[model samples]
Target: MGADHAERVAHRVSGARLVAVSDADAARAGDLAARFPGVRAVTDPLALVADDDVDAVVVASPGAAHEEQVLACLEAGKHVLCEKPLTMDGESSLRVVRAERAAGRPLVQLGFMRRFDPEYARLKAVLDSGRLGRMLLLHNTHRNKSVPDTFRSEMIVRDSLVHEVDVARFLFGEEITEVTVYSPAPTSAAAEGVVDPQVSVFRMQGGAVVTNEVFVTNQVGYEVRCEAVCERGSAMAGRPWADLYTTVAADDGEGLWGGGVPADFLGRFARAYDLELQAWADASRRGEVVGPTTWDGYAATVVCEAGMRSLTTGEPASVTLVDPGPAS
Candidate 1:
């Protein structure tokens, strides 16, 4: 993700310059920096944040490193675009939110790129238009072909399902008040002791309901889909509406016709990432922050933390958010 963001800022996003790249591995950073003209490699992340030439930053580091690095960016008064979770837990995410509040301006934009995806944007527009009446439910499906051995059951909730949590909030225009996670039998491709598929039900403050099916070991393809069910109508994204309609002779009358899915999220959301980075860059150049804010990130983290607890206790958990006071 770090490499992907660097490439976007350097070659794609306008009004932004990839002045420096940082990694714990100096050689890796140097190699990546060598790909772009005048881009320097900074071995230490803190030094990268403190670099005199860096006016803004993109934090694609591991979630655990987010709090410190984001705090460093706030301390330096640089606008930052931090990837999902904001931090590993709600407490840490709240701290980052407080820091941003203390800065007296919005400087942190979260990397919830799906919000920038054209399909989702249109869906949001439809919901807001009142043509759908009132959105009552949202159904989301997040499936990956596979994952690393290190990816665990908890990560299924924290990382993959977290996207749907934000989607619910974005579409419903309310906080997720509760979460109930259900884990069925693990798929054959699942790692030992890891749940491959997790079903979560999110209750919104507006009395709307959202359901998410997160299956990381689907062994099919990377598919991210969402459907909004409103009082009068419905809309969906990532429905694989193919250009051709045909029935292959190999399948006889089985009626198997659908577009191919991407191998991973990077392929599916490439354009979204580009748009998101472009918007962030455009906003940062004006000394303003846009897109998903730190509070949104923190709220998602709080919901995910509750979902994790539900995974353990096999019960629904209530989402509790600490209000950041006025001026949030």
Candidate 2:
């Protein structure tokens, strides 16, 4: 994902060069660097930060490693763009927020690419225009073909549907106060002893109800859809990759048609990825916080954690927000 971001940023912004690339796998880093000529490959991220030549950093490592990498970059006095689920939990997210505040600048941007997507932006504009007449309900669906065996248990909430959590917060323009988790039946595709599909219901502070269903056995394709039903009207968005084709038989039949689903998430979100990186690069260069802020990331983490707890205890979990660090 970091490599993809770099390529998109390079394409969108002129005079922007990738100076260094790093990965735990030295061979992968070297290969990425080779793809972008004149870029240096390094095994250590610290080396990239220590170098005086590099201007900023993009943290696309796994979720568990994000807090440390983001804080490290901030301490090194470099701007950073870290991928979603900024940290494993709210506590670590707060630490990153504090580190940014202590740095005396907005150094970290969370990679919530939906904020930059055209459809989502359009939805936000419509909602902000007051045409929605007080958003009453929000429904989001995030389904995937399958997750790795190790990721079966909690990844649905943390990694997959977390995007919906963030988007729900953004769309409603309010915080979630409580969440309830419902586990349907386990599917054959899910690993043994894991919940394959889960539904999360949230009550927003402003009396809006939100529900998200994360299903893991969509062998057909990857799907993402959202609908905001308001008193005035309804706005809906989704990704439907149905292809139509027509073929006539030997002067005997009218026509034959077919369609297929998009293979995976990367294909569906390719444009969003490009837009996300371009906005981040532009914002970083202009010294502005353009994409999702660390605070937003922290808030999403809080909601996800609450949902997870609700799943475990078979109860509705509540979310509490502490004071954001001193004004930046």
Candidate 3:
């Protein structure tokens, strides 16, 4: 994701230019810098953040490093686009939120790129139009072909389902108050000790409901789908309308359905990622944040922490979060 964001900023985004990038792997940073002329390579993330030539920051470091780097950027008075799990836990996320609040403006845009996706944008518009009446329930599913070997069962909530957590908050226009996670039987294809698929339910403060099923080893392909059940009507997102299924049937009329699914995250969210970077860069240039704010990132971390606790305790876990202040 760090590399992807760099590519977008260096080339795709209009007002953005990659001034410098850092990686724990110095060689990797050098390679990326080589790809983009005039972009410098910094061995340490802090050095990147402190670079005088850099106008803004993009926090894509690993989860543990996010808190320090993001806070440092805020302290440096640079706009940032921090990737998900602003920190591994809610406390650290709150620190970032507090820093943003103290700054008296939104300078951090949480990388909930789904919010920028065309389908998701349309869905949000539909919900906002009051045509949906009041949203009662939302059903979301995130499926992937597989995860890396290091992936564990807990990632079903903390990683995969976390996206839906943010989406619910974004679409419902409320905070998630509670979370409950239920694990079904693991499939044969699941990695050892890992629950390949899990369900997470969220209760919103506005009395809305959200359920997310995370399947990281569907052994099929990458796909994300969401549907909302509202008082007046329903809206769905992420379905590919350009699907073309070839028929292989015998004279007896027996047939098989076949089509392609997204091979990876980039395939599914290429446009969203691009648009998100463009929006982030444009907003940063204007000294404003027009995307998901730091508060949204903190809310997601709080919800994900509760979901992880519930995933193990097998009980509904309450979410506790600090208000990022109305003026923030």
Candidate numbers, best lDDT first, in rank order: 1, 3, 2
- The candidates, ranked best first by TM-score, are 1, 3, 2
Q: In model 3, what are the clashing residue pairs, if there are any? A: none
For each candidate, what TM-score against the reference? 0.96, 0.92, 0.94
Q: How high a TM-score does candidate 2 get?
A: 0.92
Per-residue lDDT of 326 in model 2 = 95
Model 1 ranges off by over 4 Å: 242-256
Whichever of 1 and 3 has more TM-score, that candidate is: 1
- lDDT of candidate model 2 versus the reference: 0.81
Worst 10 residues of 2 by lDDT: 239-248
The whole-model lDDT of each prediction reads: 0.91, 0.81, 0.87
Kindly list the per-residue Cα lDDT of model 1 for residues 1-328, writing each as its tens digit.
Answer: 9999999988998888889999888899999999999999998999999999999999999999999999999999999999997999999998888889988889999999999998899888989999989898899999999999899999999999989988999988889999999989988889999977989899999898899999998988898989999889899987767343354444456656554678899998999999999999899889998889999999999999999999999999999999876554
- Considering every candidate listed, which one attains the maximal TM-score? 1
Local accuracy of candidate 2 as per-residue lDDT tens digits, 92-178:
998888778878989788888877777788888898899778889998988887777887657778887789888888888788899
Which residue window of length 10 is worst by lDDT in model 1? 242-251
